[model samples]
Target: METSPSLAGPFALGTFSSGAGPAFPGLVAGGRVLDLSAHAPTTRALLERWDDVLPLLREAAAAPAGEWRPVAELRVHAPVEPRQIFQSGANYRTHVIDLAVAHEPAGGRPAEQVRAEVAAMMDRRAAEDQPYVFIGLPSSVTGPYDDVVIPSWCTKPDWELELAAVIGRPAFRINPDKALEHVAAYTIANDVTAREVVFRRDMPEIGTDWLRAKNAPTFTPLGPYLVPAAFLDPGELRVTLKLNGEVMQDESTKDMIFGVARLVSYVSQTVELLPGDLVLTGSPAGNGLHHGRLLRDGDVMEGTITGLGTQRNRCRDER
Candidate 1:
């Protein structure tokens, strides 16, 4: 499940391709990987200094796998044993409009209002490189094989392809310039949602405050592998999403509202980050489940992030 927390540790990963089979690639978990979400208390205690953990990950990667499960057979739990799960919203301008258009009642000035409102929402995101963050519970975590529930109220469930990071060590009041040192590695995140709850009458009047919509069980899908941060360039990576063999989201990391370092620094100031915590950076435009296009039983969702590899999960009923 790509559970290594320290950005400088060793780890194993699984990759999938359109023309390829299972790619069981391996790497040192922390030092090489740019993500730092896999921090554990024991690991944090071991490395008093941030840079010390990286070499340890390399050494551990070389160690024998006592009872390692193959990527095909194993179920992917959340990438981090996170102390807290943080997410960003309206990070992309087009995405804000795309979501707003999904909610308007067919066609009218209200629909146009929805579009303009979404445009305004996106403007807030572009105004600052710092991401708009939210929190999800550790209890909500699920593996890749688990079924994502289609809530009774939600006729429309959506998919958001996101780049998530795992923290490797303890960080508090850390400098933004030195933020890269605290990461563990990167992994693919599918931030599933129920659009009805996000913008519904029964729920709170607020539209963008998406706590329940984004916090459902199996709502966050992660893993396949935790690729070394050093293995791939984050700026050059592309994130792709497909539903039932149809292309939905095709965007790159370069479009992010906030890069990795700024996000870590911002979060560290408020909360003391622990190993194994997760941070979902945000998703690009072209979300289906949100646009009144919910997934039916037997549909499939697959995601491929640059160096981190691919994760393909089938959709099923909660029953």
Candidate 2:
């Protein structure tokens, strides 16, 4: 039996459709989906008018209305069609320290010293440095229940479950204090990666190839619902992921070296955040690399964030 995430609020939003039919925006309440295409064509469009539409959603959830359908009868997809995706790297304090120690030279330094130094450095960066952010392709995204194709060439596929903040209002050069004002909702995203291609072997100076390593088809499995930000606190959520029923990643969002507000403000300083854009906070500790166990064919990954809901994806070899 497939497990459904217990939503935190009275309702949430998603995109769904019956077979061969065009997808529509839906207001998900209990086990039913109220078709919302009449109000806004897509979830992105709904968010574009979030201020005007929020009250309507609340009323519908409270009383229930038009074009309702059972969730089991439809196909659920990624909640929003985001025009821009900004992903963070090395944002979690423990995840970065773990990586630093794991990659240290043989017999180079004591693990304790390495950990202490990394912790201090993270503290310093949090106080003085800006976030490390990168762009991701929207083509890489697949639905929450979709099959993730691990390309035959990808020997070390890994999973990075993260919390994704959905932008509702345009924000450029916003203050860190006011960054969250632009975020309308939050969802779950698994930022799947190809480990071997992460660094360019031939060219040493040029570091990290995010395009090749992370932007393959089905590399990002996103959403089951978009829980409104009013009902959830981005800083205090618990993020958990299971690989074939075994817990691999489980941590609190409090470990983030740079919080959501900081990341959003930092990205807005460079890129104009449009309605429907996504800002992905970095994943917590317990990645496959940390466990020395990369993804393989037949791996089933289930990821969940507090209130936002869950994403279940099965891995298959690329055809």
Candidate 3:
């Protein structure tokens, strides 16, 4: 039987992804350091005509040359710079649990108090049956290994590991069932937060606002690459987080209470989504601030997916 053309992975030609040793020379098989932003026009044309590029991506991943550059030498950029960056929060039960746990100690409240708050929110939401969601600005996104600025003013910055979808085409009022069709690919995102800034800027009477807390400058670090969804089984693939070389968050996409396609459909039903736009599906349970541990200077944060590859970032204090 002839192999299907879409049975392949995302492609970038460079000496990257090869572990240790000299990078494969010449244009390596994988563009570990792709220049997507450099050729925006060409990329838009390609996405519009993905069928033509599928075969090309297959050819590239199959063969690679030696003499690749150390990861530091490569120029990396955000995988997808859509018109907007949309995000949802607390879509997972694990995250909600962690939030309650994290806040209990700090809020100086008993565990029951935290549970009571969550229970009340859940009960009210159940009565109204509203799916909570919010927006994240595009300006917050930075490339893999990029610095997540620790603004001096913000005290409670945090990180959330999310599976984001890169839209393949313009989708407005699209049905949930057909949402997958509009997904161009999947990428990893670290939704950085400035907890203090968020509350101060957004909240009314000490209540938090989503924009200031979630959309701090250089708060979202993304990339490595937008892995074509076709290459991923969707059902499998472990999502893991490591801090300072120790595993902190380890979960799977399977844990997502609301899956990717459902999110795409839910948002598109109300908002007009454009090609290259991203939907940051909610994060898994384990997060530093969620556990009462905040990020400090000289810490390394790394995120890796089973098949999608890894994004390693070294944190530095913002000047």
Q: What's the best-to-worst order under TM-score?
A: 2, 3, 1
Over the stretch 44-84, how does candidate 3's per-residue lDDT look in tens digits?
A: 34455555565665664564542334345545456556677
Pick out the ten consecutive residues of candidate 2 with the lowest summed lDDT: 1-10
Off by over 4 Å in 3: 1-45, 59-73, 104-109, 112-130, 200-207
Candidates in descending lDDT order: 2, 3, 1
CA lDDT of every candidate: 0.63, 0.91, 0.66
* lDDT of candidate model 1 versus the reference: 0.63
> After TM-score superposition, what is the CA distance of residue 283 in candidate 2 from its true location, in Å?
0.4
TM-score of 3: 0.79
TM-score of each: 0.75, 0.96, 0.79
**Highest TM-score model number:** 2
C-alpha RMSD between model 3 and the true structure: 6.5
Scored by lDDT, model 3 comes in at 0.66
Evaluate candidate 1 by giving its C-alpha RMSD to the native, one decimal: 6.8
- Give candidate 1 misplaced runs (Cα > 4 Å): 1-53, 59-77, 110-124, 128-130, 200-209, 289-292
lDDT of 2 by residue, 121-209 (tens): 88888888678999999999999999999998899899999999999989999999999999999999999999889889888699989
